[model samples]
Target: MPSTQRKKIVFTGGGSAGHVSVNLALIPSMQERGFETYYIGSHSGIEAGLIAGLPNVPYTGISTGKLRRYLDMENLKDPFRIIKGVAEAHRAIRTLKPDIVFSKGGFVSVPVVLAASLNRVPVIIHESDITPGLANRIALPFARKVCVTFPEAARHVKNGKAVHVGAIVRDELFSGSAARGRAFCGLSAGKPIMVCMGGSLGSAKLNRVIRNNLEKLLPHFQIVHLCGKGQTDPGLDKKGYAQFEYITEQLPDVLAAADLVVSRAGSNSIFEFLALNKPMLLIPLSKAASRGDQLLNAESFRSAGYADVLLEEDITDIRFVHAVQQLYHNRGEIKARMKSHDNQASLRTVLELIMQTVR
Candidate 1:
């Protein structure tokens, strides 16, 4: 058992950077409050690489399989993998005996949550989309509470477990220096900065459109592209255009310099942009590609006047340029509307909720 003097918390989420970002935001604060933290995720999932970037947080890799809706030969084997994952998670929870487990929902989390329940540990889940994903929907019954970024998401969680905690923006992002950002990217300050982010794994769609129209865009805007991991082009260099596979510590700085952003509508990324008041043009993943979560996220932001959306299916090289230019020209008005959102207490609220749950 974890005593108050030396408390422990287990965090589980993976598959995408979005799943693990909340844990990243909360981990430092939890450490500051004297809580020892541990992470449980799939061995080779995106979460492992992200968590590896952190110090002192021991990560436990467990067997986890993708929880898919469509039929596949692998689906037959997944149940066994998930069962094994549950056993591994059970062992991990029994050994750690943390005060509580906080999960940002993903397929990997289902087994962890199940193990936590078997061990009689409190589990809290956070959902970033307007609708709970299949994994979160399955885990909802096991959670003591489900924290949702979107108010609409609460409606999807059965029983009385849903809690609307808003978006948990990373506090470190507030300290970004635009000047430092410009210097680091080696981009000139003469033009407005436009940052294109394609989530963690990179969006091939976003990359192609941006690359194809660089000549048109770079003349008007200094473009900084976060092309996800291993998506950068080495020989395609242009002045006033910078490409990075990912911006780790310098992300805040890069964002600070951004006059506007073009991004996939991941809830965490969009909310951070909203908190920063960055005008945006969102290109959500098509419903054909995703479960329509990003499309919903982008539409919500669009309806709220926080962003302009050009559907992924509608993207053409010229349309991409036109959309970027449109967002750029109207950024001042868009930023003014963005000021309507109040996100100052999101981080505090989630932290407080975690402590209350632990006690």
Candidate 2:
């Protein structure tokens, strides 16, 4: 049986929104269930900013390093930073003395997981991608159970720790009002709305393509471009287009107002879009920049008839425009398939499983 006393759960994830998104979904729910939630992340990553928006969730910033795939001069320096972070995290874990730690697989999570293991606290890690990231791979052996959004990821987890919990989208995402969304963006009901977001840092490739081809798209749909921090164009303004640096409280409404979506195929966002039955034109992050996880994520959805993939290398103005047109034309069919597929298992399972660990 779960404990009757109020428990505490420390969540650690950062670097990008994908890493922190699951933590965001779980924190409020955990708090409501009488678990005090605290966050540990890098001082400057996107996580700090996102967590700041949520009241009552105390955040602790630690010294951490970015885990890079390739050799770089900074690689030598990062090792020391990681060591310092681990020491700091261990001290923090000892001070807080939480019952359990939940990690969402970012570089900042490494030290926190190590600290949790050192403190003999059970750990839960959520992997959103099919392949385990370097951070998650490092922490997996120490974790009690690893929850995954993708079933195929189970094979990659050793020691029988993987639990296929599906995707845990926030409950508030379903409560957004389209009228409020339209009002927030200054877009009206005369034309259909197409929302484009390229993950937390925004996509330069996506922003450029959409902006350059707006003339072709504007006649058909109003565009709400979430063009990351400092990515918006002040010089060029269009009648039916709106720009935001990055949205927090307004995201649900914006998503509610979208008739179609053009986005990067990070597992968390795509799954949320899937749950919302939003047909996506996915432009996965290219292999050169990432470990090709997004590429795999996009292909899996495409094969399942949930979304259409547009590879970064193959993107031209003509191809980009056609993909959006094709997605809109086939939106009804895609929505029907999405509605039929149950994207509803993760939140409850993960919540129950994590609490069970502490119990």
Candidate 3:
């Protein structure tokens, strides 16, 4: 690669933090390596809100939304919107002429990935769940590289090459050391910390469970809870709960300080915890989600011994408390298991694969 001719990579995906965090991880590395990076996603999705106000980045939007689970009036408009989004993405693709398009699968990335493929530009699909999303499955045949978080997802790709790169993680989380993390997060030198999070936007079910179990959990360890954007204002009643709608550069501190985590098993969260070697009690949402990806992600991690999965419906106050106490008591074993599967350099692995296909 020459210095003057910068490699331009376009990242398109965002409806949830699971989709968005992949780009957040890969983009800085791409930029530091002198690759010109651009992000293409929907203005309507959470990407606009999260990516807005960030520096040294350019983003363009295409109209995009999820397809409903059950047949509804909304389905009628999706086809037209898909066509419109593709045309808009085609315009963006022509204008940007990116060296590669790295798409973390989501409905928002569908048209953009399709447009890139149509233009003969290499499209890389990164599926974060064990089971591919519907949109990603539809777009998989056209992608040059179908990068996946789990080995099991390889079964879903029919035409493209399936490469398991683990998960791309932001450097901040990747670099947080335990000792410094405790000091930074204001945790006592000896007390263990439990970090609870629901993705970027937060999970009401997880929040409710934590609230109910907080009193029992408080005596065991300090809690650093990421309540998600807008959801924190309802306020949790725990004596030592540190609440944040978003944790910026300090996330590494939070991850390092935690001995255990109770969170949604979204691909980003699961892999981040795995990289940090943190024990987690993963609460995957019901199969009734527009897509059942979360449940699949949880199952994969549980099977891999990286985390314990508990269905939200099956979780009770006593069960949640017991899981926390049980995991925290055996922290050494849990952390060791997480370390066994940790691929901290996964971001580089993913970038290398994309580079291979594109170059």
Candidate 4:
């Protein structure tokens, strides 16, 4: 911790919002402790866009290849790209000389984690699903520790390095005002408000279903639909329904005003909803679109009594409406169960582990 040689950390995660959010949560804490922070991610990936504007965190983009389950023409060329990425990442890490590297589990993280291992830097990777994704599966052997959001995920790590630390909920999410949120949405207190999120990239299937049922839903609840980028519908602009492409600074306010949530079953989003004690109807991504991680993430929350799940294939206008109604009816029970869990403790444990790894 000497001024001449400050502690340094490099965060590596990308491909989706879920991967980058955990790193974002930890950066401020790292900065406050006087550690020099850097981020390594894909040049054109979502991580690049997210980390580009953060002050004091230098972002270094490296070549990354997608790790896919299915066969693709790109698959033939990506392994070479991954090799190049590892070489580039190794060069960056060697120059940065970071004390530790933390990965939040994405295809972009594999090369970075491998490079960290090669450089003799300790690496910690967090898996947010019940089973580790393909990237994390590859990176696990190189990781000094594997942190998991679910206890079941820990058992599958095989390396015996897994820690069940729950989800890392960002601190800023709790600072929202209901009045401010209502005002921002121009909503009245007369009706309950429902917030629908289709993850950061948005869900086309979920978007269509929600819009199709808006008339049925609007009478019972005011709606704040974060319809993803370029998914907004101008024709559906009606009273008590607000559509946003995305929310950044005003996200907390939006969450604060929501009486219930309808969202995709991404671990970070569901965990954030749980932390806020909001009852949710989750529609997870199908196996065709993903590795079925969201399906497992949604099931885990449902089993824990924190949420209600509606599979993508099983969704219909009537079923979706019924699930929302059921969630509203049982919201008190859901909130009570959520209150029994502790998110702050999980954040503290992960932060302590990160700091401990560096030392």
Error of 3 at 153 (Å): 1.3
Model 4 lDDT at residue 52: 82
Q: How many residue pairs clash in each candidate at the backbone level? A: 0, 0, 0, 0
Candidate 4, superposed: residue stretches over 4 Å from native: 1-4
Among these predictions, the greatest lDDT belongs to 2
**Which candidate order results from sorting by lDDT in descending order?**
2, 1, 4, 3
Alpha-carbon lDDT of model 1:
0.92
Q: What TM-score do all the candidates reach, one by one?
A: 0.96, 0.97, 0.90, 0.95
Q: Which of candidates 1 and 3 reaches a greater TM-score?
A: 1
lDDT of 3 by residue, 92-164 (tens): 9999889899888778899998899888898888888877888788888788778887888888777548888
| Candidate 4 local Cα displacement, residue 289, angstroms | 2.8
Question: Once model 4 is optimally superposed onto the true structure by TM-score, how far is the C-alpha of residue 73 displaced, in angstroms?
Answer: 2.2
Q: In model 1, where do residues sit more than 4 Å from their true spots? A: 1-5
* Tens-digit lDDT string for candidate 1 (111-206): 999999999999999999998888998888889999999998878888888889899988888999999999999987788999999998899889
Task: Report the C-alpha lDDT of model 2 over 1-359, residue by residue, as the tens digit.
Answer: 96576788999999999999999999998998988889999988999998998877899999998899999999999989999999999999999899999999999999999999999999999999999999999999999999988888899999899999998898889999999999999999889999999988998989999999999999999999999989999987899899998998989999999999999999999999999999999999899999989998999999899999999999999999999999999999999999987867678899999889988
RMSD of 4: 1.7
Candidate achieving higher TM-score, 3 or 4: 4
Report the Cα lDDT for candidate 3.
0.80
Error of 4 at 330 (Å): 1.7
lDDT of 4 by residue, 1-359 (tens): 54578899999999988999899888988899888999999999888988886899999999989988888999999999999999999999999999999999888999999999999999999988898889999999998899999888878898689998999988889999989999999999889999999988888998999999999999999999998889999987799999998887789888999999999998988998999998999999999998888999998899999999999999989999999999999999999999998878887888799888877
